[model samples]
Target: MASVYKSLSKTNGSKEDGPANGVKKNKQRVLILSSRGITYRHRHLLNDLASLLPHGRKDAKLDTKSKLYQLNELAELYNCNNVFFFEARKGKDLYLWMSKAPNGPTVKMHMQNLHTMEELHFTGNCLKGSRPILSFDSKFDTEPHLRVLKELFLHIFGVPKGARKSKPFVDHVMGFTLADGKIWIRNYQINETEASKVTSADVEEGLKKKEKRDKTGGGKETEISLVEIGPRFVLTPIVIQEGSFGGPIIYENKEFVSPNQVRSEIRLKKAGRYNARAEQGIERLAKKGELGLRTSGGRAPKKDELDTAELFA
Candidate 1:
């Protein structure tokens, strides 16, 4: 009937190469913009990312590495709703994420700055939300650079100084470090602490260790217990449907080399250079007749027959 044909046409138009469930099957599309570190390993990583999400696909032809301004334009052109931007600069790494959905904008960003292992102790511990605290091991009571890094972190986390008294300010702890000429970023969760009464032998020993005399001239001592809380994780660079933080990497250090890939480029280049030297060596040896042993080691002895007289005797 005419009605059946109309129904079939509509279904076919909305059909996707997926399951035949009752829901509409439009493929999930994501756009990745990167160039500096693109390699076979990265491609495999991107493919892995796509596989994590159900029905996700990556458009390999369209690349938007340095072209951030045209994000929206190319996204619409390619009909991709999710996009990720990655970059590296001077041992620092940056990441940015944006969505081209109809409702509203979704953006997330992460950065890793360079730092020495000894300089990580200054941040101390986290005292807020159910996230862990990520602190450096170095004490920077006088280090000016540490101060600057702390200030930069204020843009992404922490509540205003004035409003903290009214509403408790507690959130995740974000930090960075520089290693292998690249900056690495990490996120942590700081959880609340609940006080508990302790009376164990170990607790008593700890109490003795932390005993403090009263300043009031009273012959009394006080002991305090400390509890360490917080869980930490290294945030990888691969773009995901949604990560711990909802931001993308818009900026990164230049000297940064992403993970899961080897630094064999230099070796490959050196191999090319050595190729010419090898050819030159071959020519030199040929001229000297070293490799041309057939000519120098004496024309390989003429094809003389065996002593037939000796064999007959």
Candidate 2:
């Protein structure tokens, strides 16, 4: 007799859908690093990149907006084995990728350097085994860089002199296949996840709730009535993660009661920046401490007192 399970659909999860059968799934971890600012163009590029990979492959696009350290974190998060750097802008923007894992590769792209020859030489030493792809836009001539690049590629790929002439020197700025047949292209646009927005109705409802509380003279009302107000700005030192990008911290007067509170507020912002400056040697000086905080302290140190040498050192 025929088995009753023979006609079952794969959707119900059966042995036929299992990997034990001849079926195999392709899993790829891809990281896209782009220097272009996020724009509508990115949407198009993202779609194209999605098409290049096999189905079921995981992909992450790290744009210029992302923190420098986040790139490394993402590499670890996705177990990325290959990285694609998309240089979409002009001028030299230094790109460096350092892998903590011994097995991973390091890739660097130095665009439009005044010292092209020297830069290429230095890059050759830094990125010995890894593939380094240099891109030049229409404004810049690739001829000079190409000359050095050709020699580098020849040394690495071991191309015969005659065969090198026939091979296309530079791939199209938009897209091209690597020596290994891996497809790579510089696409300006790609899809990005957007933050959700609250509607006007939501704001109206919240205002109505506040009106009700005002009428009820809610004992719980903690609102402060200010007679005088002035423009105020808060400066908070932020720590930037090694592989992540860092930016300014702007807060309205309503946000903090004191400078000390800024640290706690920042913790709420992103756990990564919490206690950043303190770890780097910045200490908050209270008024009393500022007067005679140190053994030799007299008055608060001037702005120059903050030594940034440690950062560069």
Task: Provide the RMSD of all predictions against the true structure, rounded to 1 decimal.
Answer: 18.7, 27.4
TM-score, every prediction: 0.31, 0.23
At residue 269, candidate 1 shows an lDDT of: 78
lDDT of 1: 0.40
| Tens-place lDDT digits, model 2, residues 1-313 | 2445645544456564464446543223445555554333333433343333222123444565444445556656656533444434322232322222213323233221112222222111111112223332332223432233232222222322222122323211221223211112221111111123333333434544455346545354332211111111111111111221222312122322443365577767676565565554445444445756655554755534357964455
User: What's the lDDT for all of these models?
Assistant: 0.40, 0.33
Q: Give a tens-digit lDDT track for model 1, residues 174-239.
A: 455544332244543332222233344224345433342122222233233222221222332233
Clashes of each: 37, 14
